[model samples]
Target: MTSTLGFAILAVLARGDRTGYDLATAMRRPIGYFWTAGHSQIHAELQKLRSADLVGFESEHGPGPQGRKVYHLTDAGMRALRDWVTEPPRERPERDELVLKTYASWLAEPDLIREMFADQLAAHEARLAEYEHHEASFDEPPAFGDPRFGNYATLRCGLSYERHRADWCRWMLAQLGRSGERPIGR
Candidate 1:
């Protein structure tokens, strides 16, 4: 995953040279909102990319502060990014702490489990609202209407995932409430 993100960062830099902070900010703009890596993580990954010769850096003079080291993607980085995008994604390891914790608490503290579900429901509701905002902004199907289909697809995925989460959370909360076991919180 780090390698993949490294390639993405490099690809962004391929457009033009940018400082570490600038790179991090650029990542979160529209592309980063969906495929996000933290600032520290981006910095670390940039170092790794540099060591791998996927990117090169040069110090540039600036007005408000000291000179900054700006990175540019190398030819190797472009090839790497292309290969990664074309190749099949590797299987992701499953290690959901929330699911494990919910299972662990189910027998001993069912009410707490219910409360957790309620909390998740609230969080999902907020996410659903955001998704709604995105949906409202778009007048037509993404790929059908826009040339930037890649970004549109990413936004669509986010909307779909949030909607699914909201629906599932609502169902789970209803089931928990009807189970005759009072929730842990009022």
Candidate 2:
């Protein structure tokens, strides 16, 4: 079975052939599970995908000491990606630390909790602003077949999430203010 990282690599190649460095940089972006990966993990996945016959690379002369390899999806890789795109994704369990903290927050000091939520609200608003600015750059949404369409689509979801999260943070702060006594935990 192909791993998600394997598919992430293929997706980047689907846009165009890229060196491993390019693929690593692309993975550090607007969406997806690969963001936490370092360059070594990305390079390892590329080799695994190559071994699985999903990707092929060409040796190139470059300034780097070992030179570079430009990777592209094979026909099988393209076909696999097309099939995977339509299939329902395997859902990973949601493990949100903030929500967990909120559940346990009644034990903490209300002032400190308010400070934390306020910081969180600010962060969400900042991210929302950045995504909105990027969305505004396009005259309209890119058409579905265009590679940019995927980027635009993911960005829309991010904007919505940030808005909701910021709203929730505000609500939490308001609820905390309604109480006269401080919470128990620090």
**Best by the TM-score measure:** 2
Backbone clashes for every candidate come to 0, 2
RMSD of each: 4.0, 2.2
Error in Å for residue 8 of model 2 = 1.8
Model 1 RMSD in Å is: 4.0
lDDT to native, each model: 0.75, 0.86
lDDT of 2 by residue, 22-139 (tens): 8878887654422346789889998888998999999999896887899999999999999999999999898999999999988887888999999999999998898899889989
Residue 142 alpha-carbon offset, candidate 2, angstroms: 1.0
Candidate 2 accuracy as TM-score: 0.91
lDDT tens digits, residues 1-186, model 1? 347688678767866789998898878755654678889999899889988888889998976689888888888887887778678887889786766775565464666777787888788778668667766776776664453555567767877877787787677767777777644453
Candidate 2: lDDT of 103? 94
TM-score of each: 0.79, 0.91
- Clashing pairs for predicted structure model 1, backbone only: none
At residue 152, give the lDDT of candidate 1. 61
Candidate number of the best lDDT = 2
